[model samples]
Target: MNHWNSGTAAALLSAILMGGSAAVFTTMPAYAQETVKLELWSRQDPSGPLRAGNVVKAAERLNKELEAEGSPKRVEVAVRESPAKGFDDDALQLLKVFGIDQGPDMFIAAHEWVCAFQEDGFLLKLDDYIAKYPQHFGTIFPSLWSSAKCPDGTYAIPQDAEARMFFYNKKLLREAGYDDAFVDALPERALSGDLTMDELIDIAKQVVDKTKAKYGILHRPNKGPDYIMAFNAYGNDFVDPASGNLLLERDKLAAAFGWFERAVKEGVIPANNTAMEFDALRKEFYTGNAAFWMYGIWDLGSVAFPTYGLPKDEKGFFADWGWIAGPAAAKGGSPVSLTHPIVYAISASTKEPELAVRLLGHASAADLNTDHAVTTTHIGIKPEQLEDPRYAEAWPLAKATELLKITKFLPNNAQFGELNGIIYAAIQGIESGRLSADDAAEFVIDEASASLEDVVVK
Candidate 1:
C-alpha cells in the first residue's frame, strides 16, 4: 500500500546532508484522518455469502494498516446487495446500474461477465495495481488470473473457484448391483476418458431399473454452468480462438444435445427437469432418490452435508457418495470439468481506485480467502492456502482440486452471457420433448445468429 516516490527521498537526503534541525520533523502539520467510504455491489446469494462480507472485513484490515502507516485515510465498505437469483441476472442488473452511472465503487461478479463490463467502460484496468502489490496478488495461482483478464489487461480479481461434476450416490449405484470397487473407480475412469458419455447414461439406467430411486440423473433445474460442462465434453467450446468471436459448430452442438436427448428418452433424466424446484432437485439427489447430481463442489458445505446430513469426513463421505468429471464423448477423448470463478472488480467511476485496489488485496489474503473456501467448499485462490491446516481439513476441496488438471472456463466474451441464455433455452426444449438433438442445435444457431453479434458458425 505504500509507494516511495522521488520527492520523499529528496526531502530525506536534504535533511540528512544539510544537518537540518529537529524543527524539520516538528514543523510538519498533523494529518486529520479522512474516512473513505467504498460501496460494493453483490448479489444475495447464500452459497457464497462471504463474497461480500470479506470485503467488509478487508475494510477493517485496511484501517489497521492505515493506522500503522500513520496515513490520514481510512476505508469503510458499504455493501449493496442485489436480489438477483443468479450471477447472470446479477450481471445484467449491474449493467443497468452502471449505464445510469449509479454503480458502486466495487462489485462481485461472475468471471465470464468481466469483459462485458470492460467493453462498456465500467471497469478500472488492474495491471498496474496488480504489479504494485506483490504481497497480495503474487501468490495467487497463475491460472486463475486468466479468468479475470480481458484482451487489453486484467480487469478483475478472482475471489474463489469451484469444480463442477456429476455427484453420485454410491449407495444407489451399489443397490443397482455395482460392487464397491466399480463405484470407487468412477472418478478415475472419467479422468482417463475410459468412460464415455453414453456409458454414464447406461449406468444410470441400471440404477433406475433395479433400484427404487425415481430419478437416475438430475441437474440444476435452471440456466447455469453445470450443464455447460456436458457441452464442453462433447467438444463445443462456444467460442473461436482465432477471431475471439462466438463460435458454434453444428455437429458438436448436436452431439452435446444428443446426450441430453438420450437421457430424457431413457427416463434417466426427468422430462420436467427444467420445471423442478431447485431445493427439490437437491433433496432427490442427496436423499438417495437419484443416482447422479450434476453440480459444483460447494454444494457439500452449503447443502449436501449441512442440510441432508451427509457424512462430513472424507472416508465416511466417499463410502456413500462420490463425484466424477463429465465423461468423454468417445473413447480416448478428454473429460471436462468446468470451473466458474467469482471475481471482485472495481468500477471505473469510483473515487478511490487505489484504496479500493489495496482493500481488495487485503480481502484476498490467504487466511481470509481460506475462511471462505473452507466454509463454502471452494478451492482457494492462493497457493499458500494449501498449507493452511483448516483448508487441508476440508477434504472435499482437496479431492476436487484434482480435477483442475482438466478444468475449463466459460469463454470471457462480452456476448457469452446472452448466448448462454439461448443455449439453456435449447436445453429446456430438448428435455421437454419439444426438440430433438438436431432440432436443438438448429434452435441455438438461429437464436445466436439472430441476437448475438459476430458469431462464427462452423
Candidate 2:
C-alpha cells in the first residue's frame, strides 16, 4: 500500500538536506514542513489491536519531539493490516513480503521470529539505537531483553508479554472436597515444586470423580505456546545450547507425551481434544464443565471475565478462580511457565531507521504500554509500569508477574515453528490413540530430523 501523502514523499529526500532551525522553518511557510511516513505491517489481532495502534499514537509524541528539536519533519504512521489467522502464518507471509523487497518500514512479530528476520538480512540491528535512547528503553526489565536478542546481538524491541499457566476453578476443587486452604496453597506448592505433574492430573481426576465437571483438564486445540510449558517442565528445551541446533531427546519427549497419554487414559482429557473447536473448549472451561484450562493471563480480560462473567475483582476472582504454574515433572524439580513476547522490529531497508526506532521507543513508554497491558491482560515490559495506578488495578498482571521468575520462552531458533508443528502432531497422534507415548516421541524425532535442517537427536 502507498502509505505516504501525495507529493509529501517527494519532498522527504530534499527535507533531509533542507534542515533548518525552528525559527527558520516556522517563519518560511507551512508548505516547507516535511512528513516522514513510517509504514507499519501488523496482523489484525483484535486481542492486541494496540500492538499497532500504540505505534500510530506514538507518532504524535515523536512529532512533538521533532518540532521541539527545531526540525522541519513530522512522522506519520501508516499501518498495513495482514489478515493472517495467527502469528506463525503472519510470520511466513512477512518472510515472503521481505523476500520480494516490499516490506514495510516496521513490523510487529512474535519474539521468536526476530532471529528468522535477522537471518535473512531483513531486520535493522537495534543495539546502537537501544543504547543511545536511554530514556526510551532504560527502564525495561532486563530479563525481557533476552527475548529480543539473537546470537549476534539485539534485533528487536519487546512489545508485550503474558504468563501461561493452568487456570483452575477453585470452586470445583472445593466441591471435590478440597478445603479452601488446600485450594489456595496450590499455586505456592507449584512454585516450590512441591506439586508434581502427576499430582495435578490426580487433582483433576478427583475433581472429575467428585464433581460434575465433564472434563478434568483441557488445553488449546491447536499449535501454540501454552502446551510448550508442559514440554519444558518435562525437560525438552528443543535447542542445544552449545551448538544452537534444534535438539530432540526421545526420552524427554516421551515423558511429556506420557503425561498427556495418562490424562487421556484416565479420562482427564477428552479423546477428541485436538479436534474440538476453540470456542467449545473455552466454553467447557469457562462454563465450569471443565476443571482446569491450560491457557494464559490474557484470557481473563479477553475471554473469561468479559465473555463468561467471571469475577472482575481480585478477591472475588481468587475465591472461585485461580491459576498455578505448570507443576514440576517431579517433586523438588523446577516448575515452568511460558511467556511468548510479541516484539517490534524495524526493516533494514526503511528510509528512516532512526525515526522508526524513536517511534517504537515512545510506543514502549511505560504508561503507553500499561494501557495495552491492563486493557488486554498482558504483562508489561518495563518495571516502571508497575507504578501506574491502572496497572496496579489490573491485578492479574501483577499476580502473573510472579511466575516470570521461572518462565521460559520458546527458543528463538528460526526452525522452532516447524519443530513445534512436529511436536504438536506427535501430541495429536498420542491423544488420538494412533501412537503410544514412546511412539509419539519417536515420531517427533523422525519427523523433525527429516523436515528440519541440523536437528540434533538423542
Candidate number achieving the greatest TM-score relative to the actual structure: 2
Q: TM-score per candidate, in order?
A: 0.83, 0.86
Candidate 1 lDDT, 82-199, residue by residue in tens: 6677787778867866765667899999898998899889999999999999999998877788789887889999999889999999998999999999999999999999999999
RMSD (CA, angstroms), candidate 1: 10.9
- Residue by residue across 1-458, what tens digits does model 2's lDDT show? 22455354445323422332111111112332888878888877888988988887888888888888898988877777777778877788778667656678999999888888988898999999999999999877777787888877899999998899999999999999999999999999999999999999999999999999999999999998899999999999887876667889989999999999999999999989999999999999999999899999988887888899999999999989999999999999999999989999999999999999999999998988998998778899888887788988988998898787888888888799888898899889988999999999998888888889999998
**Each model's total of backbone clashes:** 0, 0
User: For residue 430, what is the lDDT in candidate 2?
Assistant: 85
Off by over 4 Å in 2: 1-35, 71-73, 242-244
Clashing pairs in 1: none
